[model samples]
Target: MESKTVLYIILASIVALGIVVFQYIYKQKAKSKIYLLLAFLRFIGIFGLLLLLINPQFAQKTYTLEKPNLVILADNSTSVAENGKELNNIISKIKATKELSNRFKITDYKFGSDLNILDSLTFKGKNTNIHNSLSALKDVYAREQMVTLILSDGNQTIGEDYSYFKAERNNTIYSMVLGDTTKYKDISVGPIQTNKYAFLKNKFPLETYVSYQGNTPVSVFVSVKMNGKIVHRENLKLNSDVNFKAISIQVDANSVGIKNLEVKVSPLAEERNIKNNRRSTSIEVIDEKTKIALVSDILHPDLGALKKAIESNEQREVSIFKSSASKNVLEDVDLFIFYQPTAKFKQSFDFAKSKNANTFIITGSQTDYTFINNSNIGIEIENGYPQQEIFGLLNNAFTKYDTASFDLTDFPPLISDAGPILITSPFETLLGTQIKGLNVQQPLLSVIDENSSKRALLLGENLWKWRVQTYRNTNEFINFDEFIGNLIRYLTSSKNKSRLNVDYEKVYQGSSNAVITATYFDEAFLFDQNAKIRIQVTNKEAQKSQTSPMVLKNGYFEADLTNLVAGEYEFIVSVEKESKTAKGTFVISEFDMENQFVSSDNLKMEKLAVNSGGKVFYPSQIEDLINDLSTNKAYVPTEKGTENIVSLIDFKKLLAIIIIAFTAEWFIRKYNGLI
Candidate 1:
């Protein structure tokens, strides 16, 4: 189509014609028409090949009609369907509405613990999560002109408040409120809060919140039960119609294992729903104290600070001593805190290593790099210089454990030597180094896993200043105290160097689906899928047990144990071939999340609809909902135009034509004895 292309075509044709005329009918002539036919075929074949090399494009236009989406998101949890017949009738009317079906693409989703696409409701979910349901609706209808209809009681037993849910799209939302809004005469026990661990023979405090709703004065008794036996009891009086009171009681830990404790509030007269009258929890009891030996060369404030922080944990007993005091005390310790190891303390360091104790080495201005370099502690200072002030930079990629709730950027600078270090092991850096407010790619706090040992290194000193600065900014030492506590917990915990490792929470709520995950390693300690793992779970009190095989998933093994009831359970994980074993205990507490409250929250639903530019309707107003959807101008069908392009070089028929033209010319010349 361009003039340049036309000129190229003419030139190719002229060259092709000259060759064909001379070759076919030069002084000795064939048939007159045969000469013209040969030249024409030759020109066509050559010109077609040249055109193909140009690689042109062909396009086609198409039109599509897409109806706007009418999504009906239903809460399938048990609370929403307390009145089942009424809910079913509302659903039937919405489904049978002919006007909605004719105008939009209607979709149904049932959400509770999870979301599913089904035409009917079962109402078997143990919990209702309104926030998650709305979030799922936004994700499922992202690209459509969506009009979402929600049907729920507005009772969120889990997740955050849905009234604060921000819409992800410019879609309209309408809600049909369910459940009775009238408050009933009830007494309930809220979630219990207490310490997770207690030392043997020590009494730990437990706090429980009691809620009452009634016009009459109520007298309720709160009791704590351990292993189905009452340990403590108290009585309280409520005068207000709706009031909440926190009851405190102390329980003694006499045994050393996982102790199952239950806190219950006596139900009042004429109380029909008694599921929320009680809640259960579990606490771990340890008989042996965690002995932490802090060894230093001098009496500095940093030494005193370390001892004070570690002792704040009631379960730990910290002992301070000089590095040269004696090696006898190190024999019975579980953890060693070494501050600024020098050449003179080489023997003390060797003695700690010989006993296979977990060690935390703190480097400072007085550290002897040459002595530490040859200690085989998985860290080496490559070069040394004068001291520098560097702030702590947290490593976002650290996955060994969770960091405490504190901002590392605001902490004061720590003093460390201006030197480079070489870490020749598998390490995770908890905190990196920042100089002059610029982050440097170096480790300030790191952990190393080498040769079946756990080690930690803090590459700076003057950690006392961090505590002082933290208190000045926040008016409290809670952040600094928690950071140090978490670090000690990580160091003192047992390291699982076995070929098979099982990961599960020590405590689970009954309202959730409990899942256990595991990993298998080969002889080289790398993850291997070919290994087979199985687990046998036993109820400690019931004396009943069941074994289940784990299925391989995403390079690990997993098993679902959501069917287990509330009780203390012990699990044994084993590999049949390797004859390895791992044992642990987990407790499932009675959740009672849905039964905590039954009244509907109509105000929340009203806010949701108004904020999203729509109207709220009661369950009986389903017909009105259909009429509003049909008449709304924004919820109309959409038309889209699409254009598709294809390349000429990809046309197989064109290539075949070019090939046949050349083949026919060769055959014709051969038949005429001009080959």
Candidate 2:
């Protein structure tokens, strides 16, 4: 309380005493025992009422003992369930230990595909993500002095490696292995890499690793099969020192549609697990091809580079033609590459507009800006004197398609006419211009879609230099070629030109849920938030079908196919009140990630323990772990104190006392006929 409040309280008491003396002694002039009692009552009532008006406050201090957090994370994946009996014993002992229960607050969780409070364990999770679980706990107990205990087989099938995870300085992590440690003779095939889309009549490459675990020299045959027929085969010899072999083979995409392929390795005679000896994957064989017409007024090396890059994919063909001959080839072309277009190319642009075909416009010194602007191509450039060399800076916000595969940081600059460019149409800039180490916020490559026609604008020439630089850095042309191919694919793709666009993957792992997303647009091309979307899924093998509504989330309509069984599925996404619909197919492989391991990864568990300032123990040594935690000096309880100010007027007991005093005084007066 402040000095002013103390002064007010003292004055209130003195005033109360004076008022009581004046009433009982001065005014009444009576000397009796009753008079003394009346004076005391009056003094208390006046003081209490004055004190309420003053509202004096008092300080209070409170102390509490905050217990440290003890988090127990257990593996609920099927791979660790083999040692469930031992795991249960360890958990029971920890729970029954009074030392730990009194020393810290205990929280139990079981994790596999997700983390959940410990109620019971079914051990049916298809995947294990140890890193994700640990990351979540780090955030939840960031401020608490926490000690984490994990029980798992260390067979992480998904997410990044947990051995590299960094724990908080105030927190410690201990791991307990919970599977067989004995190594057995095993041969497995895994980690198959292949493209999801293949061109018909073309051969696609598939790479896989065959691993063996045994001391004896063994010979096995790795084979690729399609529709129960062997397409390719190879023989491999392995010993204890050389137990791993990488097998790469190309299989013909003979037919169209979805093709399911299986890769198998001959298992050892005494192999304990054969579930991992074979892997299945799916690839879609597309028969549709795109034809591109590249028309230019002058011959340049960029023309050759663009043609080579765009034609790298077997599904696309690029034909070069002079500006005068562009009109004859525009009839059958799906896309037009207008390179440094001049007045002579006016008819080609008009033809492309009439056919509603997509075009990739490349501008340079020879570009006729007046003709281009008059052609109504949604862009206008004011040509200036000297040419500017601008480097490409990738735009991270570009959403039309993915450009993650391109590394534009060290690319060579392109030559363009020095000018101030203006684009009236709304466009997604794929690459912005950077001149002399400064970002100019100008578009180097942009895409626009209007009137159902898609067009891409490149504000410079000499793209061949970028391709050459990419090849020099990466020692391959695939990266640069794929980058150009993606742009061409985007321009020629018919799906983006539609009002309803759907996106999904062609292949998914059975351990994870498959998701299909869609976007609906109004007549003005704005996102329609009120649109309702639905999907109908049919299993190709099982011949069963189901329909479900897609929920709107974060501006996209999504459907989760978590309940679908592992097989090939075909789905159709449609809008409820509109005729817009999209059809696609996907395959879910029945590959259980958790079941791929035959023994616990003890090395990883040990590394994780050492990195987190803890120890690794097995189920039998859990008692020692408990004792260590109990004696650890860093995991002690902390003393927490809090101070609060409480007002005296807020007390109900004070009010009760005032009421009682007044009542007593009234009764005395009434009994003495002084009412």
Candidate 3:
């Protein structure tokens, strides 16, 4: 079929018909029908030339079906701010341009705290989540051949990994990075937990953390201050790999209430940011010490020695229960010690009546060897006692000794003729290494009843002899009191009662939506219910949940970080147990990577041009682009090309000319020409 350009060509045909009529009228005296026909043929040629002027071409079928797809994408996270660049606000600025809107059939999307089509935009959301926004893009344009435009700060806080977004691209993705990238160091102090109030005068553990870039510097001093006065300060050296530094401080709090604790570290010379060098935490001080119960056999030197030893150095409540005499005592002591009970095992259970107290059983100077031989304490004495003393094992989980002086294997096996005592079965051996216990010839102190829940400390020789023999070295053993203090500190220290630590010292703006990650190592860290985490602002009292159904991921258990507010929030994250919860304090700060945003020197719209399959030209060369697009799309319409037949018939100028020629023809023939 022939193609026509413009309704003008059709109007030309009407003019040609009028020419045929005019020729017939002027040559009325000579009957020239062939001349009129030739004139009509010439008019057709003129109309054909006019079609050529419009420059029509056949629309090529590139594929079986022409499917046009449109993709809409936007930044959904809070970190998209362009730092000082102010480029994020340009999204609104660009919308005001009339030229861009008129150029294409557009679909718009916006993201801030959540994914949404950008019918409206407000500056009130918390932060942006990029992963969810991308997923929304996939869902909305799933079936279309799409070109996606992403507006973000490149700070992605969601997704298993971020490389997936960058590596694989099934569709054309145009990234319009909204922020500039730069570096800034910030330190912040989180909330302090004052609930399980700890106050033991001049020193208590004040937990806080330090955040710095990797390998930034070393040799910084950290100080703890209370109420505008400095209390404790320690010099510290740092490594780059140590992004976090959690230090337990010795603080002095006189009484209970809201008290400010300032954990300050000396600023590094190269530390570009110094505002976060000092962190402030709050605490409620209460005068309380750990409670201890000691069950001794009779009045001995060890009591006075222990009392003075514990009193001068340690902080604890000590109650002496001479089990051979009294049965009545105070309830709910923290630790229970049974010292060579002359009475019997009945007193062991009686002293442990307070369910909360931890039990510690010691070998006595006159341990009922006859009864112990028949009982199951994991060790049994020989019928004829060995002339020499021996020591065998030296592992904390297994044995409690610095070094083995005398091997217990030379004495006798822990198993008696009755049964096994301090050891496991006759078949099994418990050792992480091959240095076996000397049980082959004669086993020493072994864990007989493996069900021994209470940790036992066994000594082969009566260590009281060492206490008496200490006068030899006046300088070395000058202070016999110090040795006993170390023993008591290890025995009574509530190291097990410490909290799982979460610290927030420094965070960048880009890392705002990131989860507050912490480091923890439980001898056995496992899952439990009734676990809740409370995060409050560093200065303000606002709390949110950090609880997740699952506490572990990739071997490390984690608490969820969703629905958290922005700013430096102090967090009292805790794991609840049967008695008291293990708690740790940390700070969480909103990171806006756009805070580093800078104005780019290169403003070329390469991404915008490529995604749209258009070529980018300098501002001076934009005319070529506009002209080319207009030239390519100009006269092309419906049938994917020029509609020749419709154009030929509907030309208005040609219709008016035809009507005038018909009217003149009718007037000449009816009134003058034919008559």
Candidate 4:
């Protein structure tokens, strides 16, 4: 309490005492034993009430001992079990150690593809990710005194190498080697590289690296098979000096739809792990092709750039023509690209409107703004000025299609007529304009979907410069080409427009979770929040079927099919209280990534231990690990203290005493006829 508060408390006590004395001794006519009792009660009651009003607080300090944390991470993957190593006995021994338990705070965890609290171990995980588990524990125990113990074979198949992982804090890591550290004669077929989509009746390239682990020369036959029939085969020879070979094969896409292919390498006779000798993949063969026409009166380099980008995809073809060409040119054209449209292109624009064809319009200084505004193409420019350079700023809220991968931050700007541009129809802007390093609230590239027809408008020219800059930054042209190809595909696609859409992959690994997502829209094509969706999946081989509802998450419905076995499955997604459904098929290959390793990765395990200031020990040396942990001088308990201020008003007992004293005085006075 401060000096002012102490002084006020003393004055209150003095006043309380004076009131008691004057009423009982000085002002009374006679003194009695009852008067003495009354005087004492009054003093106590008055003083207690005054104390409550003052509400003085007392400080309290508390001390506690905080022990260091000992986190034990046990491997629960199939690889550990297949190597004939059990971790339960070791974990039980550590838990039973009384000295360690009394000195440290122990926590138990199990990890395979992910990390979780320790439970009954089954060792049935199909994939191992050692780096992910360690990284998670490092984050959970950051900036604290901690010691971690990892028990595993270090055979990870699905994550980055664990040896290179660096800890963000000062932590001790000890590893227990659990498998036979022997390198056997083995042959594996991946990691393979190939395209996911192919054109029908065309050849697609598939490349793979075939490796051998032995001391002698070896020859293997690499074969590609489709639908259980061999389509291509080649023989490769490798020796101890050259233990790996890059094999490239061209496979023909004969039919339409998805094609599942198997790439296998002939294994050695002494190979103990044959699970990795073959790999499975799928490709979708498309039979439909799009034909685009670029109608422009002037011959510019931008025309050639656009044509090359569109033709990068074998499924699309572009043809350039003069605006004065006859009407027959528009008959078979799926899409029309009007470049800097002027008075000469009025007939072409009229024909496109009459046919209700999708169109992409590009504007520049040469463009006839009066003719374009009068054409009633859903866009109008008012009070146009001289041409100026405008840079592009990507709009992150654009949901019409994916533009996240395009890096347009530093691209060169385009020349456009500076003015207030207006669109009479609903549109979504993909890129906003930036003028002279200042962001202008205007659209540079936008798409419009009205009257069942799609149209895209670019209010600038010199787009070829952006493509050139992309190549300079990335050392390739695929990024720019793919962006243009996706834009053209969205405009020219002829699929029936429905309110419900489903997205999923056609192929999935057996160890991965296969997820199917869906979106439902109302009659106005806005996202419907009250819609309930369900999925019915059927196994094509076993003829078994199951139905379940999809959970709504982040404005979309998702269904997980991780429990399904390896096989071909067909599914249908339907919306409740509506006549909407989507059907699709997918294949799950039977591949166990855990079974690919012949032995434990001992070198990586040692490196992880050494980098984290610890050592590696085998299962036979488990006792040494425990003793080392117990005697480590750095891992010790520390003292922690906390302080709090407690107020006297918070005590209920004090208030009870005050009430009792006042009541006793009132009852005594009333009983004596002084009421």
The number of the candidate with the highest TM-score is: 4
Per-model TM-score, in order, reads 0.64, 0.67, 0.45, 0.70
Comparing 2 and 3 on TM-score, the stronger one: 2
Q: lDDT tens string, model 3, 482-504?
A: 64554455455434333354533
- Score candidate 4 by lDDT: 0.86
Score residue 525 of candidate 4 by CA lDDT.
91
Worst 10 residues of 4 by lDDT: 77-86
Clashes per candidate (backbone, < 3 Å): 0, 0, 40, 0
How would you encode candidate 1's per-residue C-alpha lDDT over 555-667 as one tens digit per residue?
88998888888878889988868788889888888775766775888889889888888889997787788899888777777788898876645557767877888888878
What is the C-alpha lDDT profile of model 4 across 1-675, one tens digit per residue? Answer: 567778878988998999998888898865888888988999989988888888777678899999988889988888888543358888888889987898789999999889999977779877788899989988898877888889899888788988988865567888998988988988888765678778887999988888888888888899988877899888988887898888788889888987778889998988888989998877778776788889998888899899988988878889998888789867988899999989899999999999889999998888888888999888997646988999998899999889889887468889998488899998999889999989989999999988779999898999899889989998988888988988998898745568999999888867366899999999999999789999999999899999999989998999989888888889999999999999999888777787878888889999998998988998899889889988888888899999888774655877898899999999999999766
Between candidates 1 and 2, which one is better according to lDDT? Answer: 2
The C-alpha RMSD in Å for every predicted model, in order, reads 11.9, 10.0, 18.1, 10.5
Off-target runs (Cα >4 Å) in candidate 1 are 1-31, 39-59, 84-89, 119-122, 214-219, 228-232, 239-242, 256-258, 270-272, 289-506, 511-513, 517-524, 527-529, 551-557, 645-650, 666-675
Ranking by TM-score: 4, 2, 1, 3
- Name the lDDT value of residue 180 in candidate 4: 83
lDDT by candidate, in order shown: 0.81, 0.88, 0.47, 0.86
Cα displacement (Å) at residue 606, model 3: 9.6
3 against 4, candidate with superior lDDT: 4
